[model samples]
Target: MANETMLQAFEWYLPADGHHWRRLQEEIPIFQKLGLTKVWLPPAFKGTGPNDVGYGVYDLFDLGEFDQNGTVLTKYGSKEDYLSLIQSLKEAGIMPLADVVLNHKASGDSKESFSVLRMDPANRQSPLSEPFEIEAWTAFTFPGRRDTYNDFKWHWYHFTGVDYDAKHDESGIYLILGDNKGWADQERIDNENGNFDYLMYDDLDFKHPEVVSHLKDWAKWFLDTSQAAGFRLDAVKHIDSEFMAEFIRYIRSDINPDFYVFGEYWKNDAAMTQDYLEQIDQSFSLVDVVLHMNFYDAGQKGSQFNLSAVLDGSLMQASPDLAVTFVDNHDSQRGQALESTVEEWFKPLAYALILLRQQGLPCIFYGDYYGISGDFAQQDFRELLDKLTFLRQHYVYGEQNDYFDHPNCIAWTCLGNEEHPDGLAVLLSNGDKGWKKINMGTLNQGKVFIDYLGNSTDEVTIGQDGWAEFPVEAGSVSAWVDRDSLVN
Candidate 1:
């Protein structure tokens, strides 16, 4: 089977001109040429406003289809434009994964009176104040939608918590006071920021049968209407784990078994992500946040960082098959909330590590591939990204060998499989210029390998023992391949 690669088709600072869907459609041929097997489009829903980045979700059912939320189309485009993008991706043999934001709902239709207990932001498990009555925007009737697809109306009782109190003109984590409304079981989510269940706006109560039923029904409707091949679940850590596991199962068994789901667990600790993986029963893959942090650490440390331990304690190292590895993402952008950057000089090395490796499926960021807006646009990695993807699609297959013993340098090789006789070798250095003797196996014996990256002009010939020393520039990456063995 061919390798699977994903492209995050949008960025945080994309133009809010309601042309993203159309722009993405225009890039289908480029995506195919770059060997992208899947594309994770931004959330197709209506958020707090037309320009909202889709995280401040206002309506799960409003996928730029309804006239609500002060606009008929989302930041991307109209519902018709979104469906057309999906169809175009399918026709191009690329899978479309919709961004699913189920953690909370924002900008309700109306405010309603409700009893609540204020909780400490530091310790969500501890109540800070006695029961008090407050008004909140918990009533979501979606007036513009008006009983079109599903007539499910959301009420205060359908949620567990809210962040603002219209009555008191204050903002705090207010736990809903009712028969069975509370934060999810403390054991079911991350312990950060106390309970971690109340992440903003109106937090949905997954324990509520009606709430559960409505969300599930909405997902089915979304899948059917959008014709997307899978979903990229946002903020899985804040959502109830039991409900998430069930949600993954429902969509796969009920709609399509081949349906893929990539989750954003957003935990820098591999063990914490692993805990969620076990909770979900390994039903889907997760974006490897731990690995992203690893890249950040190495970039900051430079030669001082141990290249041998670059992959250590990362989700990609622990669970490669279930890991969706990436170098940077929307949240990690310069000014984003979760801002953590891998130094610009080290980005090429980072891409090579993820794209050239065989363990985990890789995802390329739009900002890096197509360039971001504003001053950041000048920071381009397009040329290197294109070259790496080309190498990944053509070579970098079959039996793999690792040479990660050095503290400042590491390398690997791929012995060609029967069909693809042009396997490649990759070497990266965090310190000074380095070279390593890698074994390419007897199949590659006597083959003359040259650096595909053009960083080195040396054409090293493999001896009868199938071993040759490949060189890499200081603080850079290089890929080597048998130029004569190429099919073209």
Candidate 2:
């Protein structure tokens, strides 16, 4: 497989105008030109309602195909529009990575009386309310999508718990116990809330063979219907790792063997992420949340941040192959549930660090590239992202050398391959401006180098020993490519 760069093509604050899919279709050629190998599309399935962001998954089969949720179209456009967008992306040589939410299902059809015990939100193992019969909204018949795809009618038995009850008109975490019904195994999941299995609304019981079979069928159907290259699994830490591995294997075997899958583990600890990866037998890659946190800390601290320790305790440093590096995501964006937004000034440096390196697969967030919506209106980083992606596509290859010796500044060099002539030297600073004496490995001695990012206009000529003193401004990043390579 080729070194891939993915783009998270949607943000949480995207307007519910039902034109995202169409907009993606229109931007397919532009994304191809930007050298995006894959585009991680937002959930195309119908959400709790028409305006929902699709994370509150209602009907997996109903991808704007039926007249449900008060509207036939999703936040994105109709089913036909989504399929067309996927086809366009493929035609443009870009893989469409569908966002798959399988951990839970929300917005059920009706309420059913069931014996439930309220569990503490902080400690899910500790029950707060005694066993009592209450009318909970867990029945999902998909009345609007009546048997169009697979007729898997979800009931209270298919779920382990719910968060709300219509009878009391109150909100509390309730676990449906009795007859082998409970949360997933605590030993196999994150210790948060005892077991992090139950996230929101009707948490699907992966232990049930019938539920697993239905999900498997839906996965197959989704792949076949969308023709997506892979999936960006949502809330993997809350789901069973073993079940995830099996699902990935089953889908890969059933569909294309080369089908890729990555997940949002959302753990700040690299060890926990590594353990999850081990538990799943390395079936899927995970977003480098640890690295993102590091970037976030650095961005927040500004010039005082330690540049040398940027990659410390990061998955990219330990296992680059399975690390999906990203600067910001939907959850990490401003005003989201897991908001730890990276400062705008540090994004270019972050992008250069991830994109110009011969390491983890980098994902460009749409909020950064195209600017975000709502209260947090971000400045567009398209030009900077474009230059980095261009270098990544055409020049990033071969051996890498890390000059992470400076406290306020750090540098790295990538020796170019035969396919991509000339090397790349990257210099970043979170503090005062500085220069680093980097050796380009004598492959291009006496060659002139210029900053591809246009941050610096000065050029440096390599010495007989292939060493050049590269300078960058404070709180900025620069990528110096061979001057000869810059001549189109």
Candidate 3:
């Protein structure tokens, strides 16, 4: 079981003044103090423009290095600032996980006439328009970058499809056919729209050897330049699974053998995620989207939600080792796509489950830690998260025993270890005030325990049997640790 905790260092709503990397550098010490072992930084490359959130990738080689797309610095900061941020994180004993966007490239340099078959947005297999010539923005020379790192230029031949035509001012999915280049195999990807291989502007043709070679080179360059501990591959479901597996193998073998890699599949079905994992030869971990959806559903339903079934149909439950558990991410937060924000009241309980559990590596979102600006300014879980992080760092270890017997209340205990010396008892309730009797192991016999979260003021002395009733408030969660452990 991996015990390290990761913190997402950026949110979607962060100020676009291009100073995020500087701020992250300043907060490195604070992150270390919070017991975060790894920090996941947002995309460091220049996006479509100055205000782009780094997702609308224009130039992969330009990490805010040149004055491209009307900005010398990205939304986060300049290339120098990004490198400094990674160095600062390493110095603070936290590994930096770089966000890698490899699905598609956007913001072309010019337009070109091409014959394409328009496909239905709903059903990509079905054609909507006949093969017609139209001016599409598919040429990317990166003139501003001027061949700084890699001089590879992209054109329509390197892509599988496009979504817009500049001449007709039309918006539709156009399948770029010819030269044996097309969308990835439908059988290897999500079933949505026949095939989800084409996501945004100028989808890269993974079938093309040149495209794969260029991407691999870029990956090596990225790792060498940023010195990131690992990669967070974006939109894996939209890319070919075989290509991803090959990419991971190439990067790990040629660059960093022990490099960690995880992907964002973004499917609500655990089976789909598992299938993708199998397709990738289980080479990388995946964000547990199913678990996140469960959290969202539980938060929306509140007390009516069945707490006992919280882990059902979740990737964490099915494959804990390969699941990166999280409550909310940038895409799930307000004002973004895939918005399924967990209710504010259930955040503490959610964090307790993920952080204190033995299964799944927990990821703390920056939006949840530092409140979002604008409409969601009042929502901040930093204090609670701090407490949870402290408990996770100190007491979340050893073997675990679950007591998930109730529909609205559930509890578990982590047996004490020789290193930590004391164990933890966690209790949660979604309906009303409740308690569960859990064994903290025979080693904890006669020890006094109190809720570290202060949810309950009462102290419970463990009987000789080493079991005690842990109580939590209605619609809340608590972690009970040995009182003596606090002093040492």
Query: Lowest lDDT 10-mer window, candidate 1?
Result: 371-380
Kindly report which residue pairs in candidate 2 clash with one another.
none
How much lDDT does each candidate structure score?
0.90, 0.89, 0.89
For 33-102, candidate 1 gives per-residue lDDT tens digits of 8999999999989999988999999888888888887899999999999999999999999999999999
Cα lDDT of model 2 by residue, 394-422, tens digit? 77887889999988989998897777767
RMSD of each: 1.2, 1.2, 1.2
The count of backbone overlaps in candidate 3 is 0
Considering summed lDDT, which 10 consecutive residues are worst modelled in model 2?
1-10
